[model samples]
Target: MGIEGLVAKGAGTRYVGGRRDWQKIRHRHSREIIVGGVLGPITRPDAVIAGQYDAGGNLIIVGRTGTLSPSQSAQLATLLSPAQAGHSWPDEISAYPWSGRDAARPLTKVEPNVVVEVAVDTATQGRQSRHLMRYLRIRPDLTPADVDQLQL
Candidate 1:
């Protein structure tokens, strides 16, 4: 069965519910805001907000609403594929369903603790989206260089 199918079976009908609070901002890497792969003279996040999944089987990630340039849109697409690549943490933790989040409870903390690297065809100021976000669970034994070398 597909991963989604498995998650659905495990999740039943619970949703995490938290998509409307995300702070959206432009793509800010360092001090430069990139839009259409071009560096903007100023530096600032296009938008920022707190977002979470909804209660009705929909993952609603909301932030400041802004138009994404073609380049930015492309970059965003890459994130989707990675976002679906879910894994467990704690090494010994058994993969099990949770209240929400695909019915599979992520073993470690969802943010920071877990790092996902996604490939970007191009980036824009508001949101550099090319595809889907690829999920990458950090290995405690791996060095920074080891992780850096692997790009989405």
Candidate 2:
């Protein structure tokens, strides 16, 4: 797993800023760690697992990885709550970069050079349901919008 590779290389911790910088890279490079490219689509028949930490240090576990039983899903949800509970910045990762409550919009823009796939377990629709819980990956090519179109 990417986390294992990062640890092997002596990377003690990773941040969302690392993700932003990786997106700007020309090609996927892994001197010390493997990284985001291995992760697959959220709706792929085969799944990928991933996690992200928001500013407050809340770890959000995401991606299908495989079919999750209800109990497992709940456990995962609990693990990810810190991110949800501690997100004070409305625009840290949201469609509205400035923040005005258009949560349905894509949080990160998928550049042509970078293909990042994001895996999400469920999507809820509502005024408050703006951002989707996602496990992001830097694939060859990917778009957050496609996740919304997945046939469940």
**Leading candidate by lDDT:** 2
The C-alpha stretches of model 1 lying farther than 4 A from their native spots are 1-109, 135-152
Q: Model 2 scores what on Cα lDDT?
A: 0.27
TM-score for all models, in order of appearance: 0.18, 0.20
What tens digits encode model 2's per-residue C-alpha lDDT throughout 82-130? Answer: 1233333222233341234645421211111222344322222321222
| Backbone clashes (count) for model 2 | 2
Report the lDDT of model 1 for residue 83: 20
In TM-score terms, candidate 1 sits at 0.18
lDDT of 1 by residue, 48-93 (tens): 1112223442222221223334454344333222222332212122
Model 1 C-alpha lDDT versus the unseen true structure: 0.24
Error of 1 at 136 (Å): 5.8
What is the C-alpha local distance difference test score of each model?
A: 0.24, 0.27
Model 2: lowest-lDDT 10 consecutive positions:
30-39
Q: In model 2, which regions exceed 4 Å deviation? A: 1-113, 126-131, 141-152
Model 2: clashing residue pairs?
103-130, 115-141
